[model samples]
Target: MRRSSVATSFLLVSALGLTACSGGGSDGDDGARKAAEGLATALAAAAAPADGASTPSDPLAAVTWTGTDPATVAKEYAAVIDGMDGIAPSVEVAEVDGEADKPTATLTWTWPVVAGGDPWTYDTTVALADGDGWAVAWAPSIVEPSLADGETLDATTLLAERGEITGAGGEKLVTERPVVRIGIDRTKVTAAAAPASARALAELVDIEGAPFVKAVKAAGDKAFVEAITYRANDVPAAVRTGIDGIAGARQVTGEQALAPTRDFAAPILGRVGPVTAEMVEKDPDAYRPGDVAGVSGLQARYDEQLRGTTGRSVHAVPADGGEERELFLAEPAAGKPLALTLDRRLQTLAERVLGGVTPASALVAIRPSDGSILAAANGSGTGGQNYATFGQFAPGSTFKSVTSLALLRAGLTPQTQVQCTPTVTVNGKRFKNYSDYPSSAIGTIPLEEAIAQSCNTALIGARAKVKDGDLADAAASLGLGIDHDLGFPAYFGEVPPPASETEGAADLIGQGKVLASPMAMATVIASVQAGTTVVPHLVDGVDVSVPSEAEPLSAAEARQLKAMLRRVVTNGSGRGLADLPGGPVIAKTGTAEYADGGTIRTHAWMIAAQGDLAVAVFVQTGESGSRTAGPLLEEFLRAAR
Candidate 1:
């Protein structure tokens, strides 16, 4: 019967009698069908839009009136609905029986018990005859999954513990550590002063004040406005003292699994916090409101493995002081540990060394034997840029190592005679060596001597020796300009085909269309020392495959290139590193030029190898590779020993 027909039948039935009766009447079948149809309509209305709107404000409003004592049922239904977090309820009417005026309606309730569908359905009958026309006889028992008499709907959440992140030696990289949460305690200060207080805190903490001010101004009058979270040891002693002196500012201390030092490999470790609304919408099955999970870095990349599966249980509580029945039980599992390939000592040291650089700078170290990343450090002056593995900058003269491979592939040896000049022009672009180019190495010299002295004009003078794609091929062979999946954000060097001879000349000195991360340059130096490809890796067992068609460098050719780089430290531009206390060393220097807001600046770069260790250092806006980057490399090598 139509919904209107059900209304008509209900009016006729109520006029006769809607209360429970002793026997069936002549129109019992029609009344039963109409009552069942009415039940279906009421339940379906709960899920339908209202008055041309997309969604109804109160989804269960229609069903509330269909039960006995509408006032009491409405409150109870709202309570149950409010408690359900990830439930989508649906209902259907199946059959009915008894007198036409006091018919019993059979109903089936279906809803997903778990996310992504593990539907649980139950069938029950409701008496539709009371004082009103076809009034519904409702109770908690007729709800989805058949709630027990006098029992209320509820939920119990079992949270899985967050995981830990470890380093190469299986030492703790991130673990439960003390932290400080700085915020404004509303009870101690008026909301009107929130903006001023935020500015004060910003000045004291060295963070942006505008966003904090806005957040504070928008918070409730009695809300505690949290500003930022920092590892306990990270908050400078002076800053913490200043905070303690503030009238309304306070610190909330807690412990969480995090890096021992807040800035130690921060870009790689990431963080965990309360789940965002946008994240929940994207993965509804994996999250809920108020849940916390990894948001970025390795924490987010391995969140699933780190945050183990959650266990759940359902209990049927009794109204009378009796025992509760266990309806469902699933034990929880703790999270697992994420292992990395970092060297804790080395990473810590690298951070300290770069901490003072005035311009953006980075240091990357790797062990070529197994392609493991030991350290990736970004200086405080970098403004939080992850240049160690992600920043793309011209590599400068350091790229000559790759060019040497190209030269080697073209039949030139270290002793081959090549002209080293003051300047040369290619494709209408004039190229010159550094202004202080040593006169002794500027004339006709051995090919190795040209590389050692880092002569731009000399390398540019030999551009005819390299064809289109040959430099790119040679770079790939040394693991410089290649394709890779390191399982993290990284920029392997890129060597696009030079569009002109000038571009080729630029390419010869690590300029033009070339770009590389500190990590990429480290791999180049490491691969040269190892005589093959060196693909950098961070996470253990997470194979970082580099897809390259370029042939690997031969042991013989690698030794030849190695010998040339050695000469750099012993007799040329890199001579400053000759007296390093560490074991014998091989090094190359580079200076890359780029335009910064209409002003010209150069990036200083150096790549070196000593024993099993290989390192790359970069300083954006530096004078020269040897002068700017040499000391940093020396410091690292000395400390590593």
Candidate 2:
């Protein structure tokens, strides 16, 4: 029962005098307060372990009971809260009251249900009599005011609704969707037939049979061991029929957080499932067995904000078949929605453009105006890798754009003439153009024409025009090497300063050691189109600061770069995208060579900017950027139009 502070104080003063007279101690007020405090300390010690120990101390050893056995009362008290997930209460002496022979101490019991939550608190009084010293008067009311002799407490968790993941314009991306949980219900079949049923169900669901059989054998007699979960409509008719015929197979329908399609932005959006053992071990307060949580991607990164707070309640159930009464309750709070800058329609279109690609590939698109990432799609050939924003590969001739910027900053203009030779050599290493380089375009030509034809020799020949770190500085202005928090997992391309002249020459054509993801290449074109440095972002409302060390891109440089790129689409390798549906497309195509397994392989790359959208397409194995990645870019531009 709750009493006002004034009344509690008055009761304590009256009880202190009574306790002094009843031989609590000879020192009157001080002695009585000390004795009462000692009793409170014992109650606290018995409530829980000291310093996070697993086992709680015995209450019988801490208290002396009168007219009742201490062991029996302690056992009864332990059983009252057996179902509370090992939660312990904080018991402290609130006040002392009553007469000379029967002084009472009110102990406040507060139970911790969840981390950082308001505790469940209530007051219960214990009688104290001087049998030898002060002995606790044993009764059911000492544990709780309303706790009867035969009632026990039970705790139940109330799960909160998971929040939705929204795209640009607040359209729901990951939300509640119907699903079928396929499993083996062991109770429906005899133990002898369970293994055969599990194997049959596994084969019908396309899972391995041996593992399913082992799992079925290990599960409890009444346990339901799940094999897999699929979208409700995705389960095949034949598989459903096979499950129904199996001895113990069952299907349960439910809703879970899911995207529009299984693969729609999967690597970025992630998925939710039962918490793993590692997750529970890492933060036992936040997760428990059978708890569903985000396991990967944005879902895992923002799990605390998206998973919401789980509510808990303790009910007092009567052993004599009476109605249960609530002792504590904490209402669950729904999770907050996470917003992203992705354009669902554009993202879906980009994925479709690469649907037929058989090599590891990626397509990334961005809005240069605001630096918002519109789409990041990976082809099936990527084998579940997030190559769109994290793949690090040689950018090939597309890096000519960064080299051009370095040369432009060093006083070389588009009109300046340079030789586009068939081959160039540095440090005894001969470098030649791709096999399909045009014979007519190979000769002394303007720098702009050299870029339009993607002349590797022309750029390498101009390596002396800029010193070391010049290429990296230029790449940084185009958002290649510099890292940003971005509020998500992303890999910025790397462009370290060359260690030697030969390496320097190779760096100019984006070869030696330069590496970039599709997102970084997309940002390069986006910067040129925006006329300023662009930092690509996926999650909404995250502050991505530009590095102070990076030289800011100027309008004049972007304007000249944009013109050279436009000429490529109109007259050079990117001519395939010249008739794209969108407005005039400024583009660059690249083919980089790398030795794989003692054989030569090439990475195809193409970057383009059309109207407000900038796009990059990359194929891990291809003939050439113009032939491989350019067509995908053109298809996406047309569809996105």
Candidate 3:
């Protein structure tokens, strides 16, 4: 049995050794011996020092870290390693007891022996296997505490403060405060009761006719909750009672109610439209869909200061649908109001005086001292048409002022002789005076008399002696070709340089496209009277820091021009104005013919200045200047005086 056992054991060993060499499993004793030999070889290789390098004196060394908390350092290290390409080693953190302000902790990690992948592990001490023993590298000092539940990580940003606006008299024009507007729905109530609501509303409100009707119709059959018809800035106590008394009518106020006045100064004060998509895309903060903007006149020019900042408020309501209550409220910002240089009284007078005239008349009045527009009115079948600053008409004999100025600048005095005849021929074209009748043999008439009588033949002959360019220049100097910048849309009447001799002759007579506005004519007269050219302005004291100055003209020339104009009123075609009660008034009249082929439709015109007031009037399709515009101007001048 012993022999068999020995043989069998030898066979087993042989088989294990074959298996081990051929990549097969081995017996226990043989495997143990081979593993022991491999371990010895590895130990010897690790213990040996590198070539030309000395061995460490303290092989099994320990290290202590003394800096920030161990957990923080570990987290930072992990974050840094995660950002790197290779795998990170494992690390362990241990807490150390301390006060909240000063934390304490420890961390331990092992440098792994494997060559591939992550080569580190966690242990009691931060150690690395070096030859036959372990070596501690670093030990952390403290542990970081976890962050609390609710803490802010960033801050909120605030907006800039808005600017303020005030009137010329230092009155607050706009403010950023809350306001209420009360309106009534007439459709919901009986027509018999409409007068009651109107009376009540009129007590504290100004009703808008067209908009009110539209709003009521828009509200439809809704009763006890009807939409507001008119908007008021602030709801007065009396008005609120009236509004509440009418069922379905309510109050609608706020920034939305500040729609600009559209029809009040139409053409002069332009209309506003809804915010465009382009506006919002360019500046998301500045404009929104329903925002009110100024389109023309003083409103457009001072839009920046007039429009105040807008604010928002948040209200807290019961989630369970209990009584609605206020939590916190933010006051709304309001816009500033504007006070214009326009004299309302004079404006009314002008309108009333012109009302009875033909449906195509216009009038303008200006203060020569400061250029403040005192009154501007127009006549059209419809009340909204603006002709004073917009309508363009032939100047007729009024343009003789420019011709006279040109003649004076060219050394021709008022006494200079010019032939007056029934007809004169120039460039194959015939020019005639107002009538074909004969006159006295006084072949030569003074310039003043020629202008007073509006003698087209004499004036046209005299114009031949003046330089062509100089006449054009004089017309420009008198504000004929220049555009009017009144903060609103305006037309610069055409005063083209004469292209042909016939055209030149026609131009001398204020025909052939010598068009002007009544306002421009008034400005020309004002300049001649005041000895200075003044730019018309509708707002006073707009800039406290920078005041406007007048453009000067020759005083002697102004006197001569004034004398001629006075002669027109005292003894000429404009003589009808001489009988007025006020002091002597200087005036001129014009009657221009229609261009269309028919019986000439006359454009009656008059310009007069008395004391500090200066006025200009034009009536279209009238028989004559003295018959139409003269009477209207007389009434206005009387009121002004």
Top candidate on TM-score is 2
* Candidate 1, lDDT over the whole model: 0.76
In candidate 3, what are the lDDT values of residues 1-641, reduced to their tens digit? 00112322232233222211111122333332232222222212222223343322221111112333334433433332221112122223332222223222234332222222132333232222121121112222111111111211111111113333332244333333344545555445765565455444544455545544443444323222222323344455666676666543557654332222223334454433334456655654465433455545444566555555443322222334455433223343555555555565676677778767656777889887776677777665435666787778887877787778877878878887878777888877998877522365226888888878878888788765777577666665555556645554445466787788777887887787688888778877776777666566665544311112222357777888888888988767788888888777888777788855766676778888887777889887776677778888988988787
lDDT of each: 0.76, 0.83, 0.55
Candidates ranked, most accurate by TM-score first: 2, 1, 3
Model 1: how far residue 471 lies from native, Å: 0.6
TM-scores for every predicted model: 0.80, 0.85, 0.59
Q: For every candidate structure, what is the RMSD over all alpha carbons to the true structure, in angstroms?
A: 6.9, 6.0, 23.5
As a TM-score, model 3 comes out at: 0.59
Residue 224 alpha-carbon offset, candidate 2, angstroms = 8.1
Positional deviation of 221 in candidate 1, in angstroms?
14
For model 2, the superposed segments whose C-alpha errors exceed 4 Å read 1-75, 97-103, 127-141, 180-229, 235-253, 320-322
lDDT of 2 by residue, 1-641 (tens): 01123323333333322221245534444444445655454444444434443323563554556777757767777777665655766566688753456567788877777656897889998776754456667666666789888888877777888999999898999999999989999889889999999999998899999977987997767578888889999988888887889999999899899999999988888899878778987887788655789999999999999999988888888988799999889988889999998999999998888889999999999999988999999999988888999999999999998899999999999989999899999998888888888899899999999999999999998888988788889999998998868888888899987888888888888899999999999999998888888899888778866777679888789889999999998989999987787478899999999999999999999999999999999999999999998889989888888
Candidate 1 lDDT trough over 10 residues, lowest sum: 1-10
How many steric clashes between backbone atoms does each model show?
A: 0, 0, 15
